[model samples]
Target: MRADTVEPPARPSAQAPATSVPVPARIAAHGASAADRVAVTGPDTTLTYGELDDRADRLAAALQAAGARPGSCVAVLLPRSARYVLAAAAVMKAGAAYLPLDPATPADRVEYILGDAATAVVLTDHERAGTLPAGPWTVIDLDEPRSLVPAPQTPADPHIGPDSLAYVIYTSGSTGRPKGVEITHANLANLVDWHNAAFEVSSDDRASQVAGLGFDAAVWEIWPPLAAGAALHVADEGTHRSPQLLQDWLVEKQITIGFAPTLLAEQLIAAQWPAHTALRTLLTGAERLNRRPLAGLPFTLVNNYGPTECTVVATSGEVGPEGNHPGPPSIGRPIPGTLALLLDEAQRPVGEGEPGELVLAGPHVGRGYRHDPERTAERFVTVRTGDGETVRAYRTGDRVRRLDDGRLIFLGRLDDQVKVRGYRIEPAEITSWLTQAPGVGAGTVTVLGDESGEGERELVAYVVASGDQPPAAAEVRAFLAAQLPDYMVPAHVVTLDALPMTPNGKLDRAALPRPAVVAEPAASPAGESTDDVKVWLGELIAELLNLGQVGEDDNIFLLGGHSMLAMQVVSRVRQRYGVKMTLRQLFRGPTVSAIAAEVAQQQQEASA
Candidate 1:
């Protein structure tokens, strides 16, 4: 870490006033001042500050009685609801860190996290409690009326400290499982304080909680506004997924502050909104943003960047409308109390405007990964700056380039950088340009090995089109070839209506459909029609599934076809013959012959 040459934006500021109040304490203060104000709104519940504070107090007392204390971990396994917010506030009030568990988490993964964190109590609703794996831990159903009782409003805990664990979030690990990241109250307070100030959060503002319950962004979504006496609106499932629905919901609810992941944010910003819409700020993170907002977007579009190890957000900057700026939007400068250093593999600072691994240091840094000292040591290390001072920092595995103005432009993952024919490539760089290509709504590039060549890999591009007609694969390839080097251009392109995303909103690379194979069809047996629709479909199926051959009676799914691949096939058939096909029809008759017959019937009806 070279601090002497580092700019002010990358240096930890000692002059910044500390905003390290425990989150529960801050919320209680807000409750005292704004007791009648709306604090949380959900499908079936609307909580005033007084009611929310009282319920949290009651739950805190129950948790304390159920063996939760300052060092204990309490797991919250509820869906996104007002009760989930109450449970989080209560857990912290009880002087215990809450381990947020997504309701959709696999039972085994839930069991593993519960065991790994040594959770003393589980706070979940009745509907989700039955899904929890049996373990030697207390399970308190939040839906059970008898489980809560009134307690003191302040609900102060002498054991709570700035260094006390606030939350333990589990991020996907490189070892094919999950690892828990331990964040402290100080770390969380820094984020809440920065967010509240940066976004001008106030009691008059209604913030929306749309991120998955277990995502670290949920912490940012919950605490900052609530602490500032703002109302929290829990978006319904449909609103959470559909950008159009979310836009309407935000306008209808008069939500002033909202957050969406990168891809969703791209679509949301491009949409038309009323001139008098109440939304003033739209925040996005959790992935590299590739699109700019449309010219007339009335709100400030802020792009944030951070890892779970650094308490949700490290850098933030407002994104200007398209054409106002060139290239993808920057992640912005480091937030207050945080330091961002761009360092090379040799642990030295990279030259200005050069790419390097972003290493972060300061109060925002978390305690480290839970129960994995070895992995923790590998990622979190003490480094000596040029000033001869040693500081502990978390190494974010992301590759980024710093602009002259000190903002960070995300390049891609350092580990994700692949060498193709001796040339190192950043897929995100290609994607940034790919998304801007004609008729391409969004795209991601990945590397796959050649089927015929040993140890040879080529680029593969998967795109979702902006128009009804997907661009031809050859057209996309040619477009990239014009803008990029020959090696950087993808060898093949696959178009889909939408990209598959994981439950947490990140792109699911593992679920991406493989490129369709090309092969010459074999001759049909004597007397068989060469242009038979069934025979044609069999060939399409074989190529799509990369099968040696597909028989007429063979089921598509049985031959490794999935919903996404089936969608591609259906899209192809519609484009080729203009026949309407639905997923239900595909599932009803999964065999090639059955689908061919359905298509033929549709064609015959059209002709008649």
Candidate 2:
């Protein structure tokens, strides 16, 4: 992993995955990393820097032989494993861009991405191979030895330049489909450089990978540590899903650097951080961070803000300690080399007190959305700089006002799109799904509840029935649950006679009615012994959400309990019961009565 700047081997000979001092990763020459350090680690697997470099070299030679080259898109559908890292590195080594696809996504979505990106090859495990839609892609199964058997035992570091595409990450589109953002190697390198400098990344640091492959944040997770000669601990699916398990995993791995989405970060911050926790830095982004960081945290928490168009991060701020925060912390200034412009609706610079669109211009900004020339032209525009040089910039839809102190304060989105639990989502996408559902005619999804120092802001779907009876709320909920992620699914689907509209025929957002609370009450646990525990849990949950009362049978999330509130529950339960209640258990059984049962089980086991 040591930066061996000596001219790279024209064709670095590949042995089977093996590493010694001087790892010599293909990216290592350009990336200041150490060779002997552990490059990637999973729950059961670890790949040394040298091994990772060699394996990627071997695989890159194979990919080049199989008709892949620079500018080609190679999709990887493997889960979070050593192979996932190997495949991504291999693609880059082959001078081709890596297209990461979540195997958990619906097949149709996967198919769309493959075709849209013109994927040249697919590197996946046997479990996911059978499901890939047939295409021009040369499918290779990681489980099968034959996939790598024919590869030339050498590395092919093709002529890769900064402008060459590095990866294409798809984000939710306003038009009901996802748009792929094309990022180049230069963009990646710039981000890696900024990350290393900002965090003081080093070979001694152990970073954790929690973001899924399909996410852009995964780029930050995979690259910086490897480039900085650090060990990257891959969080298993369970650990990534369960805040309780993720915290424990970080401690067990002695992770020093970690990144999580806004929702999960809140829970991790609020949790009972073990005294031995080794995490020193935590990076969180992707949604609004409302909670003031708590005191006594061992790590420095940085709230980052960025659009996928601008690599992974744009601005970052280390939140102040408890009780000293002036307000919701600002997004801070731009990173080194990036320029943030606050322009008003007229394209003129806005005053410090005025809100304007945050336009970003830098080497880190992505090449623009793939295959969508119109959108690319609209979003990524060329502007004359103060130095009289022309540079491309991305128009971020986020509205922000600059403070007199030079920091930027984030105002809510200026469009219909909203971020729910760290996922950038379009209400139109949900409405599109709803309008397609049986018995639903016109549908509109809007955010409800005040988020600023108030209740949880949640999505509400208002629908007009196509048939005599409006679609059953449960039926609509089930329909969405089948096709979309949990975050995209509306908590309540309200049926109305007709959607309220303005004189101009647009939906009047302010006139949307509140969701009628029609959820059938869950049966309360009716035993005498557990009543006290249930009552206590109920009070704790009620206090967290500021509800009048939380029934023993009620689901917290249904009653507007988001990840932030859920963490408060976990924290409060631990303080009261001296029991470590997990986020997984809460998700499994959110009701107070059910949690009381889990607490009892954990206690009995601990005693045993």
Candidate 3:
């Protein structure tokens, strides 16, 4: 179960020659070969290589015709679908930088990103086009099937150099605004080449697109396969939710390579794979990888580490059973073209076994954040190494140590930035909102997750109530919804009698409650209608709350069931019985028995 590191593989010979074209051209060149295959699979349909290329070419032509000039920032807002991928390809092909907009992002946030980036146009499907904010921006609908009228082949614009910007990915900003990271063609190409070469990828290899297009991980998922002439399988939202479906899709499509955050990987492990699975290499990054779930997987698991400033990844290590013994496996050595240095606050190299900030320098380093010179210069700086080489290193803000074996062991962030479900969450922003909630006393919130040196952890909130009566979980959640996004909300809320403090009276995060997992019991014996409903409702509530048990009168939201989970319970209730109820109705009733009575009443009304 241990990975053996042999000497680095021989690089491609001078005669073999690497492709010098930008990423879009490289993809086009690969797609030109009829034999080259790129299949994007979704919940309902799949597109072949020819179809994908044709669609992208058509969209690119359309973009050009629609006045999208070179270097223009074209915002893209679409769900995880083929259209999203094709639109991205189109934007690149049109010689414009694609700005990704996450569907789950708030409308105001989307507006801020678009305005901040000064996007010239937006390419989205019919489903999401209307959701865009009202502006003087040009929008292209890719969902509408247009005739693939071959446009005049515009000669490859040689002016677009490798150093030119390719895309701008916006990360959640700590200061109430989002910051866009400008990634260059060279940066992306280097990462794609490194990943493909490191994994020995081939045209036969198939990879999964699990992360959303907005996430930096999606860059790894998309470009690597296309650059290597391999296949990229796109999984829809539902497919991503069900681990079994993901495994089945991977097996059915013969996926040989894939990447996901540690959170999604843990879900795959919890779902329990079949006796056999066909994953050759599973890459996890953007967050720390837990060792427990990765132990028995029948694939070579690699832990990739890097910030968005370092393109996709700077360092990667193979996870194995032997390496799992000493806490967790190392973050592995730097990739071939990358140099990882552990530097102190003064930017001096820290000794081996001493913790310091991780700094990265290489071809994969991205250009500083778009249009934010002050913040950009703060993090990205030039430093002279002990070897007397001056290189631009990105201060990752990740605390780490160089182990005796030359691998880096990640400790945690020096800042308040924490990773949840693979996305970085700034505690300052979350706490800013939590402290403002009415009835909540001066509150200091801390994020706890599996990456926090424990098992898979969700967000848990420990609040100090203002008065004798504490606000309900529903009210707190409602307040959070107005300020924070869904993923940033704490999954569990513990109304602490008082906030725990450290020896010096600082907020103690370690004392927070770990998310409790509730298991479902075996089905009960056939019984009276009311008793049967009570047992079923109790089990449902327990599962919803992630609690060991639930009483008939226990309030659902009070036990940590959020609005989303309330809807899920309602859906499950409808599926079990031929009855339907709305989330509002569930909130009003607020109890399992109450919901059951509503369902029973609805069923009776329908029958009558």
Candidate 4:
């Protein structure tokens, strides 16, 4: 049998377990032995091990008095801070799963999540208490002095077992609403154990917490280090946005370990660093990595791959320095205690090195989506192993191919497949090739209708320039034509200063601007082409802004054009004129006449 084609490992016995210690219990043990050590370092405050334990214990008692139980779900709505970690630990100590809610979440969405989870208690700061929608749950403001009234000095020890619910994280649902995923203590414990052992986390290490409160990466960032008795430094909002600022902060804090989303990590590894630094390991996931770090890097760059359904990570490998390989590094083999299988549509194992759906079975798998039995039944199923043992598994809709050494390379999502002109295309493959083009920093591809609503889809590419001069549309197309089929080349290539991203650091596809209509009436006379372009662009702007008509010299911004709308206008101009138009040009001019003059000049320069 081929090495990569080996059958899945034997199913774990029901009586055996992956981890013997729960997360809360580990934190308590650390508090006893390292009471004076700093547990959390926030922007404005610091908490010692004793203080964190006592405060969380007091909060847990209050929650219990407020009628929280072993199976109840508590809601935590606070910004990233020392209190945020305290609240999560308190909920687990009270024997209730904590549901994270970002304060910035829309009020209606927050209301829906609270109602759906049947949350009985909500933990937040006093300043943000009024922001919450009126709900049936009891609110406890951690900032209020009365809320922490004297309680037992020791930690609260409720009956929290491996089977007890740990946390319920909500993920974006396909139906435009969010679904809560229930993770048990066993699942969380396995992650904590694996993280601590894999990363060599210890009390002397200082880790950074950069993910938001609602993202699943935040859970992974918070618990692993704290449970191991290390100090977790909370990064400010600005540090997370700029790669240079983040690297400076990491150096200033002397952080030994850090985690960033895939996009940010790609930028961070490419940025310059000091000759010697405290950082030893950098972990990144939540998207496919497109580039490898250059040689002579100080730290080990580890690329990880997994869905929220299977804890924070299932496969991980250290990415070596950039090499002559044609593609990015492979997501390493499955972690211990986890079994991964690649199966086709018929549930049969695919041949070696063939792409198939990634199915995971083990203790790391989440219990299932909360209040979504149908979806749970569909995604999480029982599969019989080659040895005839049955194990519950989650069918990750992601496609992957196994390497000879058992490493997996992430293909695009099964649902994200696009069909253009009777040919199936994976946009990720195109994006990867675009990023490899000269003078291109990053890129993404999207599919949109032809604007006639006839259901004809075309691929639109957006790229960021690595230097002052952006790659011309013709040059980019020629480059892609060499690496890809003719049909796979994008119909429109729009260059931008940067790609739009969510607060959690994932690509925001819905936020991508749509390409403009390419069909325009030609000039009536040969000498009137520039005037014709101005008139047509003015009319297009008016139509997009929902105005009856716009004057040639009117400023679009003053006429209610926002950043998103500006991007749309730029996309239209780039496609129509075949020029490398950017948002800066629109912001500088902000009028139809000014943009038309610049466009005409660029066209003249191109001809010259």
Reference-based TM-score of each model? 0.83, 0.70, 0.70, 0.82
lDDT of 2 by residue, 132-168 (tens): 8999999988888888888888856687777888888
Query: Model 3: residues >4 Å from true position, as ranges?
Result: 1-20, 145-159, 267-272, 292-296, 322-324, 417-608
The candidate with the higher TM-score, 3 or 4, is 4
Q: What C-alpha lDDT, on a 0 to 100 scale, does residue 172 get in candidate 2?
A: 72
Clashes of each: 0, 7, 1, 0
lDDT of 3 by residue, 1-608 (tens): 22333212222111212344577776666767843365566654666777767667767777776666776789988877767777788888777888988776778989989988888888877778888887767877666655234344442342568877789998868797989999888888787777777788888887888876677888888887877777778876534533345677777766788875664453454344555577877777755553434356667667778788888788887765533344545677787778888899999988767989998898878889888999999888998888999999798888887765567777777875778777787665565567557676544556664676556657766554555455666788789888788998877665543343322112345554443421123444433376678788898779767799998888887786653465456645654564545544675688878987886687678768
> How high a TM-score does candidate 3 get?
0.70
Pull out the clashing pairs in model 4. none
What's the ranking of the predictions by TM-score, best on top? 1, 4, 2, 3
Flag the better candidate by TM-score, 1 or 2.
1
Query: On residues 473-588, what C-alpha lDDT tens digit does candidate 4 reach at each position?
Result: 77888899999999999988877655666666687777776654323334344244777878987898999899999899998977977555776677667656766776667766
Q: Candidate 2 — which pairs collide?
A: 1-23, 1-33, 1-34, 1-35, 2-34, 2-35, 23-35
Q: Model 2 scores what on Cα lDDT?
A: 0.73
- lDDT assessment of candidate 4: 0.81
lDDT of 1 by residue, 1-608 (tens): 43322222332112344678988888888788888999999986999998988888888988888888887899999888898899999999999999999886888899999999999999998888788788878999877877664434345564788999999999999998899999999998888877877777888899999988778989989999998899999987546755567788899999999998887787788678998899998989988899988888788888889999999988888777777677678888888767788899998888877899999998889999898999999999887676777899999988888877778888888778788887888888888888888888778899887534468888889887765567788888888889999999998788765566655777778878677622113443433332476777888889878888999888888787765577667766665555676544776688887887777788778879
Runs in model 2 deviating more than 4 A are: 1-35, 384-390, 417-583, 586-608
Local accuracy by lDDT, each model: 0.81, 0.73, 0.69, 0.81
